[model samples]
Target chain A: MLKLLTFVKNCKEGVLRATPKKPRETRRKKILQTALEILPQRGFDGITLESIADALGYTKPAIYYYFKNKDDLVCSLVTDYLKDAHQAICAITDGNGSPKERLIRIIHFYVDRNCEQRGYFTIDHHLGGVLRKMPHTAEADNLRKLSLEIPSRLIKLINEGIQLGEFRDEDPAVLGSLIFSLLGGVLTHMEMPSLASLGVEGLKQRVCDFALKGIVV
Target chain B: MLKLLTFVKNCKEGVLRATPKKPRETRRKKILQTALEILPQRGFDGITLESIADALGYTKPAIYYYFKNKDDLVCSLVTDYLKDAHQAICAITDGNGSPKERLIRIIHFYVDRNCEQRGYFTIDHHLGGVLRKMPHTAEADNLRKLSLEIPSRLIKLINEGIQLGEFRDEDPAVLGSLIFSLLGGVLTHMEMPSLASLGVEGLKQRVCDFALKGIVV
Candidate 1:
């Protein structure tokens, strides 16, 4: 009984630590990475803290030490995913080349990430409906904001492209929406037998070719 | 007791008619139409036979007479909606004018349908996820086939456009997927405040303009 009490105390203290200790943070990252690896194979409903723990060869309590529950883990995973994607996109937008060049890079960035993280995109698409049904949480709000911000950044870049005569003079908002739509559709249908035969490089080339031609002067 | 037996007899007879009697068929159509009218406003969860009946000044039994239950009603509604859309698209595809003109008509058809029947599209979007989760039914099978057929038709038109040099040389399948993605994305985001301001015609023009520019030779 005393040993059990000590273990419980230790887990609670680990969760409440002001800053996650280094080893604990590493384990947490591993847990999230493993969760993503398993997601596409098993789907959202099939994943659980216990399953993730089992995959990592850790105990369930070890998983819970970092995340309060499954929702906490999933929420953090999505938040981090979006944060990383947003930062990458922003960097491209803020970097060298002209608006058109940056736009092409952004398209490539999206396609590459999507092809590499097929599981994440599948989960993200499913989450679109699920998140709307969920009550507003700080996590959900942050996610919504990040999702909107990424596209808005692209829209701003398109505006710059138009001003510089790199892209046709058109409503940037409309163009951005259409481009994103094309990306979303392609990503959603990537697994279709017909498209799958094109392989990654072929798919990337087609998307970039279609999207760039749609806007470029 | 005799009157109750007669009422049951009449209802069962109404359902069993070999070719639906005019009155019964008209009433069944009314039930389906009213369900659609209520679907967007109330959503799938909020809608029920009772609500649809109340809207149409009929009893729940009047609904059950045509549909076995809520699922039957929804399945029929989806089947009818897709059938109608598929037939209309075929008509346009088979009609006069260049491939470009027909493609534009198809886009217009989609935009116009989506705008006018906002409820249907909303329900359809929600149903995309729902249908996947559902066990396969004949209705589900039909709906799936029709959905694929519509896109296949578009792909064929794109191929014709390329052959005629009306469109640039590219994979018709890839282009078709991209175009559908654009249309799907636009329809999905139609309610966003940013795009809503564009109004229906403005939105239609943008879709056609961007899509045509992408492939036009």
Candidate 2:
């Protein structure tokens, strides 16, 4: 009991010193979360630091402490979300399984992510507009690279599947683009009235079955 | 000599009545053509009556004579473009051919049309924003219906293919959505730096092969 108490006390001291209570980190996260929630409803241009602070019951200065402006806030939001997505992909791809299984897993992962991240994909066109307007910015370049990473990972998985004899021999680049396109369509059209009638599983099944059929040996 | 004169007279009369030299129609077409040309470069919002007039070498009043306002002008442009698309689809689907062959033809036609109509798909997001903002307009409703009609036709073609035993047994509605999504992706991505490298034929082949493989038994 004495040793347990010491250990706990030491842990508390270490956490306090090494990972101090960075309210700014928490504040920044809160700001990003609020912005993301507001993005689909209000759009990138519509979101202001004032709006974010109002949502958080904080002053506009409080948000300024974390972000220089709206553009900065958006850049952080995009880069963070994409980083999380990249991490999710790595988690799925790094696990023990056949390459074919990993590919399907990645597909399902993306579909599920798209559904969960409704505001992300729904505002894709809006995002494209934003990217185009700010093409020379480092943030824009990062966003572009992160977006390309998805298909890049997909191509790698396809190449792995082909080498393992788990899938038909085909051009990974072309196949990857096709798969990416299909998922992009799914992202946009999932909310269409006709497609919405398919329900989520029915919609996912169609994408999965069709994608798998295209390359299944 | 008498027969030739009569034929020439008939031809002149036919041309006079058939086309009627309606300056209004010609002006309307010119405005829409200019708008289509400028939309990608300047976007819908960037376009103004003054710009259209400047492009066509007409006074802004002349444009307003044909189109009551900018919204009216855009509505007409969308409706006219979609009508042309619908006609193109009809010309293909109405022709006598196996369902599979017709499907391939439709795919190529859409790809060809997309390549020819670069600015159209690129501005799709901008158009969506405009449509959402002006939802109650008849032109918006018509545009929505015309857009839906493409996928509806795709479903019909897929159904015919199944009935003809050319395609594997599957849900035509879902399959149609998948195809539409794939095509949408292809359209948007065709000009991406990576995809642009695919060239037009290379991109079309990827879309065609993947789509056919997905449905073909």
Candidate 3:
């Protein structure tokens, strides 16, 4: 009976310890979610921790406890986003069919992701300029490295495609870079008054077709 | 003798009137040139009238005499660039062999201009985001309209290409946008370490080839 009592007491203590962490995690996610929504419209300079806190109806200190500052919050947001994007890309590139097929899948993946989380990309592109001007931090360095890796990995895939005769024998480096530029341009101008009729899926199909034709034999 | 004296007097007055205006025009050009040099490196936020004056060894008041403020200065620079670019594009589109030939010429023109004046393009791109958050000014609105016209003109050309059956019967809007994205992607990543070996001419050739292949029958 004493042993049973001790076990019950330990179980209650364990739940008490675990419950606080869940809300903290939940709160951190909520902060990131709110920031993502505001970021595309306001940009990096326009957003403030106070603004984000106000949007969430939380106190400044509540946000501070979760994020060190605005940069920290943005870095966290980008890092989380890059981590997931990198993983998805790797899974696609590593677990793929022919190089051309993988490349097509990547185009679909990139367009779909941009369509869904355009704010992240707008902020990401803006961050490219912002990070260049600011003093380098470890976090900024990691973000830069992560951003470069995506392109380099795609370039590698393009190189593989060229070697296997799946793609035309063009400079993969140039081809890869051009493909990225094309996708970015589409994203940049996706909201043109004329393009509204295509919707997301239609836009994706056109982008994939255009991008593939440039590279295919 | 009286007629000769009168002619000399008129000549003297003409020189006196032209002298100060010449220097004033030259000084304004100098200010715009210096800002162009600094803007791509520092972006819109990092530049100021004082910093520009410092670079030019002129007083801040001297810059003020020429520009009302930073936005005014940037607007002037962009306006000058757009006017020239629009005229050049119009010339090419108007005096071309075929739509495909005209499109190829445009790709070359764009790539060459970007290579020569990379800073202007970079700052112009950064301004797209900056203009969005700030209160709308007439100057900003004009800049936005001018920027939109470049692509719209190209889209019109693509539509012409489709109608003439020189290019594939794809959505002209989609094709034009994708072509722009491809060229822009080239500009964005033109400085990548891997792409360094391909000189400007080589890069332009590759870009034109890739772009034309996508839309040409």
Instruction: Report the number of the highest-TM-score candidate.
Output: 3
Superposed by TM-score, candidate 1 places the C-alpha of residue A102 at a distance from the truth, in angstroms, of 0.9
DockQ values of all predictions: 0.52, 0.49, 0.56
lDDT tens digits by residue: candidate 1, A90-123: 9999999999889878878877887887767756
Reported per model, the fraction of native interface contacts reproduced equals 0.65, 0.71, 0.75
Q: Poorest 10 consecutive residues of model 3 chain A by lDDT?
A: A12-21
**Proportion of true inter-chain contacts also present in candidate 3:** 0.75
lDDT of predicted model 1: 0.81
RMSD of 3: 5.6
Encode model 1's per-residue lDDT on B1-217: one tens digit a residue: 9988977887787644644488777888888888888887777767899999999999888788888988888777777877888899999988999999999999999899888877678665665655665568776876777777887888889899999999989878877877877787788777766678899999898889888887899
lDDT of 2 by residue, A112-151 (tens): 7667766666455455666666657676887887867766
Give the count of colliding residue pairs in each prediction. 0, 0, 2
- Give per-residue lDDT, candidate 1, residue B116: 83
- Largest DockQ belongs to which candidate? 3
Query: Which candidate comes out best when scored by lDDT?
Result: 1
**Comparing to the true complex, what docking class would candidate 1 get?**
medium
